[model samples]
Target: MTQFSKNIVSVSLWITVVILFGSLCNGGKILVVPVEGSHWVNMDILIKALHGQGHSIDVIRTYNSWFVKENSTYYKSITIPNTKGMDEEFVDDMLFKMINYERGKSQLSAVQLYSYVFKAIHKTHEMICQLITNIFESAEILKTLKEKQYDLMLTDPSWGAGILLAHELKLPMVYNVRWTATGEGHFDVAPSPMSYIPITGSGNTDKMNFFQRVKNAFFYLLMDIQNSRFNLPLYQTFCDKYFHPPVSFYELLQGADIWLMRVDFVFEFPRPTMPNIIYIGGFQCKPAKALPHDLEDFMQGSGEHGVIIMSLGSFISALPDDFTEEIATAFARLPQKVIWRYTGKRPSTLGNNTLLVDWMPQTDLLGHPKTKVFVAHGGTNGVQEALYHGIPVVGIPFFFDQYDNLLRLQERGGAKILSISTLNKNTLHAAIQEVINEPSYRLSMQRLSHLHRDKPVKPLDNALFWIEFVMRHKGAAHLRTESYKLPWYSYYSVDVAVTLFAVVLIFTLSIFLTVRYMCVKCCSRKRKTE
Candidate 1:
């Protein structure tokens, strides 16, 4: 080769290296609007992955967000000012009240459910509005965000302000929800057939009777009405006041690049889905690590009877005294050792067989060889972990999707649902015994665990690939469906049905008139002849 050609090649290679290095060093700038509550912890895996991959993340959250332990150079967190009613104490108190309300009503009627939901919804709206208002009011913060030019806005749709922020900044959004997306009123993201897919926490399944379908339909209708009447108006008002060209609030949801829902068909029933929806269930969960020495010793102490881990998630871990007493009594009867997560006052009736801790390493415990079953409230994350480890369960569901989650597990023969309102020592013990005695429960969970693990790609990688894909393609609009483009009547084919009926009616009338005319003409001719 000539000297000139060799020199040219070397120069080109160096230039290419410089460009590629720069691109790798400066990845996409992402803006996240995460929940300030316990739910914030759920985003830890995804956010941490993005950071580790060198993506710059700027999170706008409430003050003292539990999401951050220490400040990170890779990530920037800006706390919204004037935020109130977002403290752990407040959260605990509200949850306690909700538990009491459910206990008062053994089973919630539609009216009672609506009443509780309405109050909760109303309160949530106020807090969201206030936080949003704070963000807009913070001139320095708003200016900084605009100047940085974020590539994407990843948010939880439960917070309406996040959607508004995405719109105002002209950034594409991707929803990251902890639960099954449909239960959280993310109907536009995916199609959930009322005939089969039951509402979460409804204690109904995909296989419903005719009356059950009607009831489920009514429940969904009521929720929609509530959203439109209360939630939508508030969101619209915020947008109209803050945004430049105010668009329909719901339209933005349709325009999302993707929806990362924590749902898997292995545990859930198969249903209709859209192209933009991605089920990254159990992404947050990892292979459980070694238990603490103390925990290991405790599990080993159970011997042949095995240990049952009881942690009702963060929301309801601080259960009432009476409930704890009954649970304690039930545990005392069992040969198995119990580890319960409790945060409030120690129950006087707590038995020697039970070990109470402020926080329990639930996933690690579930994975332990000595751990036989999980007694939980059926939170999505907890249920996924239990199912992942192939553990049978005693589900004492309290509220929200807890009931529905347990009911599904029960149907699969891997769990038993015990109502919080009607729970007693005898009932709890029997429920636990039934699951422990049945070998089918363990077998079912093992099958499900295998199915869950036998996936083509790791869930985190799947999530990251789509996220980076959106950044590269500028929202990947091609993946979105045309369904969102249609109006309500057209989407449901109501207009098509009505138009067809009109055409058929007109055709029938025309035929009838022609027949009558012919008959009349024939009769007149016959009379003249006579």
Candidate 2:
């Protein structure tokens, strides 16, 4: 044969092998139900990554979704109509009320604050339940969803609507979870002791004193009450109305095939975890991309002083005008250039060194070497990115687990928390200065970055592998725990303890009676001889 013919044959053979391999790795379809705001941000990243792996993706979004776009190259969106779901207005109002309470501008007492928070959360969950009800009531949507035959249901369990849908569809479920319908995700699936695992809003660290433990337990019970009183009833009603035999929404949540937890031990304090729980903390983080020319020039201008970047994540467009002025004034005093993400009116105290923009490439800026300190609202995404880039933080927590997130970093000596009520020009300035001047803050954060990076596989890749593992194996039932199936008393071994106590009590009483009888007979015989 001619040399040209031989070359053609080899090339064709290689092409055929490649084609066959690609066919073998063809991706499965995924149905994603995601929460709005920052939760959507995290889920979007995972969806894009999954799409890159040749997976076909379908997203279930509300008609008025705040972030999830109706059209996307990566996924087909199923928009549910006639539902007043969570939107920008809802979030803004909640943040405003929270800020008012925190800054003592409102007449709300501490008890009122809890009441307001629970009420707000209850309203949000009520809206979600209504949305789910709309979906279930619509025969067309349910028919379409059922016809899709997705390999798995991936959802954020912060709302129980997704959990309910997954159950209705009878698909193996996976959670992209940090928060569940009740408090933290781990509390739903794992053995979370109140001694160390601090509840959200509790502000306690892993190491707690006696009073701190009491506070932690109180917070846990409070959250339990909140879940039972406000959240569970809405979902339970749905279960009762829809299913032949009503299913517990909490049980379905706990029985998920896998949990792609948004935190690793590097971010979280040491705690017991299950085999099906995979840590993918910092998965949304990536190496710094080249900044836009304007941003790059601004960063270079700082020289040795470096830059301080501030963002309150996606939800808050701007703080109250007075708060912004205080923050802007603090930024003005810093020798370091400031890039503040603010959409409110320009602060009167703003200095020449500060630049205010409506939006920012948060992860990219954090990854930059010139970025020394992150001034954030202590959202999980921002905190994890700061850790990934080895940047210290000066956390200005507003509400909803933000304080606790910063508390973890502060306990590890990487960040400082400033309450919104106490935040002012001087306090904010001092915190930024303290974090910048202290080498330990940067050093501690860098150490965490190293540990977070030292994992065998990248967090994103690990998440993808496990996701595909579930798809390939149909479900990860082998890795899931059956403990979730047990009733609360049985799981806690309260019944066994009660049984053992009863047996011991009966044995002791019998021995006492027998000894008393012998003593009585001996006494009678002695008396007769006398």
Candidate 3:
């Protein structure tokens, strides 16, 4: 009991010291949540930095992992609701379903693949999941306002209910946008890559790859269905009660006071940006740590051949057989050892040089001295991990803004992008070779790593400071944009512009008909009188 007390006291003192430092810095009640998968890891970092600064943190958990430090207070809004066991169950079920689905397939179909995904999210029966997340998350944010009384709420742009609740409670909110390609359509914001930026017009005009375009269409279609079933219902209720109608889709992010992109200029494409969109790249890092045991063994055992680390990220880590087979075929030709993080049955054709595991210590592996190349699906957290360790990449971007990330990496000469559709042994082998053999790739990557790590006060410091500043100042209103206040039709000018065009066309046609009618009538009267 005494030991526990001492530990608590030690933590309290540490918090006091950080708080003292932070008070000299800024003030606010801080609430953080991440509904998007492993992006929660970034939230963990924000929580630590804020807690260290001695600010009260209301960490609302919506996923499996929560690593709040000792003596820190937290609230769980809606959990992915799956305990670790539940997560395992989800994976196991998904893997089995995907495997069987692929069993009879000759080639992979996008519709079938995504259908399986929809089945998985629904199977989780996320009704209670969403409600719990919304209620708890809202409760935590409201509680913080009521207790420490927040000046602002720091949350992801689309983190479950954080966005909605912030608007509901009328709190100042800072939006942490993790990727860059979250472009104009996303609340008419400027370009910021998830982990990188890209060249762009007023908004990003770069066309997506086939897979990405298809995925975008698919998501949009799904959201359209959801908008009707769920969003419309909720929107109507709020409008009826509060007299403030919710803006349509793509107008959501504009509601926040600020949107902070967790990305870097060095690694991203150049693009026009708004003052409201702040770039806080590589915000999800801690001081470099030593490599883990399994990673060290994998690195040292590979010798000069080095290792190719492949991960589809947390979302697609469970390799469907068709995707898995495609990867297996690619690695078979490579002379280098491939350490693949695949949660699937190993293909019989897989070579001795390739190692398949259910999971990987990705950060530890990246940090190892012998690690050569990283093949990723190009998510923000994974990009940060790769850049942090100076590992050049082979980006097999599957969906969303991953294609943008691939573009940035390629522009820097630090990586290559292989279309997942076109990826096979010959293409992947060449990409791996080009990334590894090229000294420029290594040099470029190291330079980026240095730039990413050189920020003053660190991202954690910035996030913590902002949190406290919000509490003290009641949400730093000067930072927010009033874009969200505009209605969707007005914002897009779709109704006004379209209506005007239609009216003009009709007016011109009506004048032409009137003139013709007058001519005919005058001629008929002259003939009758004659």
My TM-score estimates for the predictions, one after another, are 0.91, 0.97, 0.67
- TM-score-wise, the better of 2 and 3 is 2
Candidate 1 regions exceeding 4 Å error are 1-26, 64-74, 101-114, 178-186
What is the alpha-carbon lDDT of model 2 when measured against the actual structure? 0.91
Ranking by lDDT: 2, 1, 3
Top model by lDDT, which number? 2
Query: All candidates' lDDT scores?
Result: 0.79, 0.91, 0.63
lDDT of 1 by residue, 1-530 (tens): 89999999999999999876765676899998876544666776688898776788988776655445436666788767567635665556656666666678336564675586677757867787888888788888789889999999988776677787888788988878743212353466667788988865455788999999988888888767777787778877877787766677777756778888777888777788777888888887788899889989988899999988988786654667787788889998999999988787787877888999998777888898888889888888899889899999889776667777777788887888887667889999998888888899999998889999999998888898888888877797888887777898998899999999999999999999999999999999999999
Using alpha carbons, what is the TM-score of model 1?
0.91
Off by over 4 Å in 3: 1-28, 61-151, 179-187, 191-253, 322-335, 346-359, 450-457, 487-530
lDDT, candidate 3, equals 0.63
TM-score-best of 1 and 3: 1
**Tens-digit lDDT track for model 2 on 30-58?**
99999999999999999999988888999
Candidate 3 TM-score, C-alpha based: 0.67
